[model samples]
Target chain A: MDGTLGEAGEFGLIAELVKIFEGSVDGDEHVLVGPGDDAAVLRIKHGHVVVSTDLMVEGRHFRRDWASASDVGHRAAAQNLSDINAMGGTARHLTIGLAAPADLPVEWALDFARGFAEECKSVGATVVGGDITRADEIVIAVTVIGQCTQSPVLRSGAEAGDVLALVGRQGWAAGGLAVLGRGFRSPRALVEAYRRPEPPYAAGRQAAEAGATSLIDVSDGLLAEARHLAEASGVAIDVRRGAFEIPEPLTAVGAALGADPMQFILGGGDDHALLATFPDVASVPTGWQVVGEVLEGSGVTVDGLAYDGPTGWTHF
Target chain B: MDGTLGEAGEFGLIAELVKIFEGSVDGDEHVLVGPGDDAAVLRIKHGHVVVSTDLMVEGRHFRRDWASASDVGHRAAAQNLSDINAMGGTARHLTIGLAAPADLPVEWALDFARGFAEECKSVGATVVGGDITRADEIVIAVTVIGQCTQSPVLRSGAEAGDVLALVGRQGWAAGGLAVLGRGFRSPRALVEAYRRPEPPYAAGRQAAEAGATSLIDVSDGLLAEARHLAEASGVAIDVRRGAFEIPEPLTAVGAALGADPMQFILGGGDDHALLATFPDVASVPTGWQVVGEVLEGSGVTVDGLAYDGPTGWTHF
Candidate 1:
């Protein structure tokens, strides 16, 4: 246990770390099965199950210098949970897979677990089980499970006459990343947005209840995700330029960096905002804004014309 | 679609690959929820579930030079399924988290999926869901779910009078590795053993049915895993030297390498063998051989004497 994870050995380290997360989640009747076996089992109970996964790697998705271990844990879990929300589901449980170098401090790993547990608690989910191994660098892979009491909304249900709406902030994370990359100190608001994305979780369930047809999380830029919905639904989506809402911190950071505020708002990723298309002029739910409308044909248009901007982050 | 997985981009690659395994598993009543959402949902009618996870990384657990993409996929699925087998349960489903560079051949990625699906079919399990992401190296993280009609046989239930048994090949994989490492291409049997491990999956359920007190997978060598069971069960285990029904390939390879055959048998890892302790004196089941006995106190002894061979593989 003194040296890196390799020195402590795989089994030894697992035995030691397993003690911390022992008996964390409450055993409910719905939990026909729990941890410490081959695979967990749960009751679906008259609802559809929602599933999504995300992987965060060192130097790729995150850097140890810019984010604490806890920050990484929170962000990783938040992103996957947001995916579940985008599918119109209520978050329930998560299974995490972690790989790190043996030299990583045990405290950091524990802190990472704490961050995950805290986030799960906020969303009424539990860290059900996970796998840990020694690797060259830290990799946090999370798979989240959710439940939908009604029909689960998908990205292929939108029609040409539907209205497009967004639930939550956008572009702040991209602006914050730019500020960090330039080594410029920024306000707490911008930094916080970059570190921990707070997606509109409850709003998703509400939208599903209110009969939203197509939906997806804005992890990539708004235009990119809009295109996904369009292609999947075989309908074109048109955005109103005046309807692009840029948060104040994002605008300030954009100004400081001499970057286009519209680019950040339209092309910036990792916002975890919920975007959906409704069939009629439905009442916009809380934490949501009317952004545009679904149109005939294919592709995405801004103010009736194609607005050429950065599409999104390309993970290659 | 015309390019490799890396070239196709993450979203595009996933969209293409998802089509293959879209309707693979036979819909079971136990699968209260299936794939294509945030998380899969499975029901446990018997009220008992088992869970385990494993991570396979490039250059660590496998090398592309030594293993075809298909072989890697089979090995990954086999290893996780063996964990369920170790718990004396039947594997039901698996969720995969895969990360590979964008430049990887799309055909290779598809082959990996095919291998995984084939293995699941062999064991009456299904690939329920998964996540795909871009990374510098290939990483395969699998989490398996299993179910049992009765209480799971744990590692802490061995009694001093119980008989210790092993149900599978012992040192074939290690001997195969030695042959491969030394560039001795003569031993085809040994090399195949190294590439693909055939664990006694059904024997696990049989052991559970026949009332096994304690059980564990021989993942990190016989002595090392026996030591784990001894520590967990608070009983000492004694391995009889003459009891080993060693295979001919193991002996032949050991003679050629100028290495101790006993070391390969006792200290070798990754054979996916099963070792358990039972109280009854019934005959050994198929695919199993009686190799040792549980004794009073703790630790493991070989041939009624203290063993000091090479300890199992250490992560640190």
Candidate 2:
């Protein structure tokens, strides 16, 4: 059989993909119906179901020349998983919708599905259902469903006196994108971070358990995410710039290319770190630092004032 | 206020779309944390959650000249909802992902959102969360989460002695496509069917309640779907050609074009009717007609013989 999707045909190609997805379904009684069905059925432990969806376009979200098929798959899964975590929920099932040109290798699609399954496994989730079709370019659309034991941490829950905190590496992915764009593959770690980010998934639940008022995943840059929390919570966020000792990778790459690391830190996005607001500074979890304070106002500020650097990224 | 997405900018355009989506959320207490949050939380009425996802690409699933943006949106939602119905579930929430050229008109995007919301509303569902990004062309991806109290109806459950039944129209959309290609718009019903299919959503629950052993939605032609049920159930489906009194709209259009309505009935895809197998002929629901008998063999047949007609569409 030809390794590419076109030679294998749609039905044959789908059979291979479904076999891979089925391996992740571990007889967990929660999955009443799994892959190869019209739709997937899962037992919802809680009364509430948390849902979120994201799309990754070929040229827009990733570059085939730069990222491997697996990398693209893992990135898509990780980002959606992060969204579920930000809601303070334990992720359950992922339904991924994929579209690629008929000529794409069956091996490529298989590897992509494998990567997606691996990422879901990392967060104790599984691929329950999906749709595959042909398109001019590859499109990965992921929808994640989750259940929460505690009340979901909402962006609108932050109060005026709450302390805003940060968890995990912030600007590593943005910096990695810069290095990859410059065609320098020397810094393997930064490039890897850009390809597959390791978000602190458990920290989100920890924040909620510790009485955090609001939570968000830093997917669209730090400043942009802060603005989201502020706008949703009706409180201004004031970040203490000195508190963030820029990660070593961002600093090293920025200095090597004569580029300012602050741009990546403040404006560049795609690093799935946890940014949360807690009612008390003492209650903030370990490995997370107080980066700012929530104030009664409209927008975000840096260093106790409104310092307007680049606010953030726009996909267009 | 430039009308196009590019002139409006990515963030600005998303704000407009979000405003439209927010109108659908409607302060429903079920939506714990709606649109602005990292993920939306919806109260699940049943113990199980059913998920299905579908993608519509610009040139593949639809053509701009053939379908309006609203029609495209409705078509996308209807197709996904049919998958949920096949599982005997009540549609609950939808999370959509849309990508379009930055230069596309904002009003077009808004119209698309409105149509999507309207479709969700038709089935007592709501739009929960979604992502908007820029691409070379318009792409709509929808994930619907539903709840089912009855056991999920799997195509693999049919027995050899079972009877196959179908509900709702077939071949109307396929015939409509043929007519529209030849530029005949007088038959308004066929044209509209092509644009937006009205699947028999409630009939799925009825089938399940009446003890349907196997189920599927005819998104791909009748012969193709019958083959699917046969393969999954390991029983040959001998469809009775005489049983399906070809819908009136397909008959009207097929005559005008001198095309065999049977070809559209057996091979033309995209009608999205519910097809199920019942243990007894008396168990079939009201609007559904018994179309075939489950036989002790493999693959599909027409009146106890082999069918070599078009096996149906392969997306790739």
Candidate 3:
């Protein structure tokens, strides 16, 4: 059973793997229809739904040598959940579509599912339904469904004079990736951050409640996401260089790779950090640190000047 | 612009393609969240949700030389909706994921979207959300969400002495495939059936209302689906040979290929015909022809004899 999955027929493997999650999340009356059906149905009450989708392909997104099947599962779920959190919503349900070679091991697939379930538990969501098919390579496409009891915090509402804030560690994942690629052993914390991101989930809801106007997750790096906010709000974002702080693990990884720590802090992605624009400092949440300010212009500037460095990750 | 899809970038193509369905459906209040989100949310008042997913890969599922992008789109949406109909539900929403080369043209992607929108209109469903990614080859995965006002007619409730009924044409799509593969020119109807299947949608809902105890779509051929029903219900299904009728177009295609029409009727898949088991003849809906009866054992028999033809389509 721990052998390759491609040997087992696609349908048989799915039937067996589905049994593991049976009765996992019982007693949720809101789930009118659960897994085992074509789709799962959830009852939504007086809330706006927030949805996001991401596709991760083998070689393109993850390397089997660097990450285990469980790592892939955790990262997939975390990325989608982080998107929902960025919009000031709590993730509630997820549906996945997986395509893999015919001869992969069943245990690998199950491990992936376990990782997904564990992450869902952390975020208060459930893996409701999924599809599995045989392909030449592996592909994991996850769609997350979330809901907000209040209005969703959009990326277009940032105003001039708003103070910018950040929650959670930044650039640690990127630094870890560099270390892994360079075959250098980084600090344990840095490697862990790259393997499984821990986003500022609760801080998102808190920021929204605290009257944060616009927000986004730092999955595509700080400069890229800040650019998104600025473009969406038709404003400029100015980062105070001295105000930016790098966690020690990131600095250690940068040192190992002989890379500039500032590059990781400004352009490293997959950190899942929350970046928001608030009207005043008093409106910032507890876990959030002031990093910059929103101004009435286009483009992002570091210390009133352009700090040329890597912008972010490009999917292509 | 109706060319290969890899020519345009993913985001630019999506922004253009989504405009095609801009007001296609009138007064669609059930859609709480539509496209542009991670997942689409639908408002279901008094219905059980039915869901199904299908993955179509290039070469394995379709040949670019044989089918246009629009044809692939229509086929993908049609097959998914047909699955919901088999479960006695009305198709409502669909989430699509498309993986293709980065250089694919934008026009082709938009045409594909238009084709999908056309089929969704036929079944009263909408393309709510989807993911786009770059891959070496083309892969189209569709997940359809459906709803039923009554209890879903499952495939496990058939009892002995129940009549077996079918509501749509069989063997047409399979016959078309054979003809296309053999390079034999055929009538337009046969080719069209293979390109875009039109399943008997309303008849499925009617069968459920008429008290269908067990139901399944003939996606894996008549005999194969009958076997599924028998296995799930712990009973035997006997099909009357004389009652299994073939349309003229299918017969012509079979004649051109010098293939037995019975083979197509018994083993052909993708027609998406609804097959149901009812307690009595009176329970069969109009337009549904009685084709067989349920017996005390497991497995399927044709004309009081076991069918030794092809078993049906296997994914791996």
Candidate 4:
């Protein structure tokens, strides 16, 4: 049990991982056929099925030294589950495809499955099936299936004169990555944010129910997503710099690094905050901060002018 | 237009790949929302949803020099789609997550997507949504969403008095792999089988309708899958070696390499043949070759005795 994957073999490693996920499926009537088969079967009992996929590479998306297997698993589940939420759906099932080096510890794979199952359980979802393979570097691919109770929210539904709103944290992950870049992990909150982001999952459904015009997850910073929303909706978005009241953790991190916290808010990625546009300020849901406005033009601007800073990430 | 992924940027590469999938989604009404969104929405109009996932790495699952990008794509699609077919389901949608190095040619990625889409299109399925990331090596993960038209066939349903039947080729891929390993690739069919398996996709539904008691896709050779079905159902399978009429291609390859073609049929992997059991020999569907019988015992045997050879593949 304490040996590497090579020692345990593929089937042995999979048996260990399945034991972790099988515990999360108790009392779930929707699962017609669970793991240990060629495929998993589930009943979709709503309007439509919402599906999305994401990949997390070992060195590019995460680091073994910076994040544990559990942390990587949590982040992987969060990112894909947030996509379903972005579409105003409830996540029901997840299938993971993991490829790792043969020398990787069996404990790492088991802990990853535990973390993934725990995250799925938080939202009434289960890991139904997956494939494991050998590779030079670790790569985790997650596909999420969700059911929509209402019409899905789209990125192209925004209109001019709509109010722009934000929910959850945006700059924390950026700040944590910055801290990590400096080889300092003292700021526990910031470092944790970078390791495992907690997306505001319920906010997406709430936004859809509140008649939000457009919805998007703030994965690629606020300003970059605003630009995407603007282009997709064929309108412009203007952000007010005074809208953000920097959190204490970010402020402390900024002071320690002698860097402006606003840059992180405007350019950092992986926070998974919910960015939405509403018909008016009154239509914006409670706990959702009004940060900007939809306008007659193109592209995103700050206070009616362009704010010159980094916008987002490009994997290539 | 003809540059590496690094030159195209992530968005540019995604845009290029999206165009390939977009062509495959035309006139598919089940797709409420397709690619270019956070998630794709699909209408599931059947008994239940069947889902499966698979991962293919560059050096392990495939070789860039041995197989083209399109071949890899076809192989990835075939493996997952066959999983759905194994459950007597019709595939509806596919979501692919691809991670590759920045130096990878954009053409390679596009070709991969094209091949995947083409394979899916053959089964009336379309690519929905996916995430692309940068990694040190190429890793392709595919998840398929399918709908069951009837009750799904499970591996644990085979009875002791059932008759075993096999559909599709089992040893062609193994023969091709042996040829490739020895630096010989004259037999086009075998090499093609190794690069992209053609599973008898329609035979699964036919078997289910004909009252198949147990079903499995022979991904890891005939003996390996037979052993799996036997273990899952708590029954024993006895394969008659004389039942196999070794194909001419395999015979030629086996003769040239001074190896037994029977070994390929018994121990090869990646052919993706459909194996099922019926209550009696009379219930076996047309075109399915009866190869064995289920007995009241445990484990799989050849000629009622243990066959000493490679059973199947292990990733580790």
lDDT of 4 by residue, B1-316 (tens): 6999989999898888889999888889999999988899999976899999999888888888888989988999999899999998899899999999999999999999999999999999999988899998999999999999799999999999899999999899999999998988769999999998999999999999999999999988889999999999999999989999999999999899999999999988798999999999899998899999999999999999998988888889
Per-residue C-alpha lDDT of model 4 across residues A1-316, encoded as one tens digit per residue: 7999999998898888788778877778999888889999999867899999999888778888888889888888998899898887889999999899889999899888888888898889999999899998999999999999899998999999999999998899999988988989858998899898999989999999999999989887789889888988999999988999988998898899998888888788788998999999999998899999999989899889988888887788
Model 3 residue B52 lDDT score: 66
User: TM-score of the second chain in each model?
Assistant: 0.94, 0.96, 0.94, 0.98
Between candidates 1 and 3, which one is better according to lDDT? Answer: 3
Give the DockQ (2 decimals) of all models. Answer: 0.45, 0.81, 0.38, 0.90
- Highest DockQ: give the candidate number: 4
Candidate 4 chain B weakest ten by summed lDDT: B58-67
Error of 2 at A47 (Å): 4.6
The CAPRI category of model 2 is: high
Candidate 1, residue B21: Cα displacement in angstroms equals 2.4
Candidate achieving the largest lDDT:
4
Off by over 4 Å in 4: none
Residues B84-203, candidate 2: write the lDDT tens digits: 899888888888998888888888888888888888888878888899888777778899988888788998999999999999888878888878789777478878998999999898
The digit string of per-residue lDDT tens for model 3 on A1-316 reads: 6566666776677676566444444665656656654346565565765666677788877777777788878888899899889878888777777888777778888888888777877877877677777777788877777777766787778999999999998988888788778876567677678888888878778888999999888987898888888987999999887887767776676676678898988998887999999999988879899999999989999888987889787654
lDDT of 1 by residue, B186-257 (tens): 588777777778777897888887788888888778898888889888899998989886677777877898
Residue-wise C-alpha lDDT for candidate 2, range A1-316, written one tens digit per residue: 4566777888898788889889989766789889888999989866578899999999878987778889988999999999989988988899988888888888788888999999999988999988888887888899999988789998888999999999988888888888888988747888888899999989989998998899999998898999999998889999888888877778899899998887778776777999999988899999999999999988998887876677677877
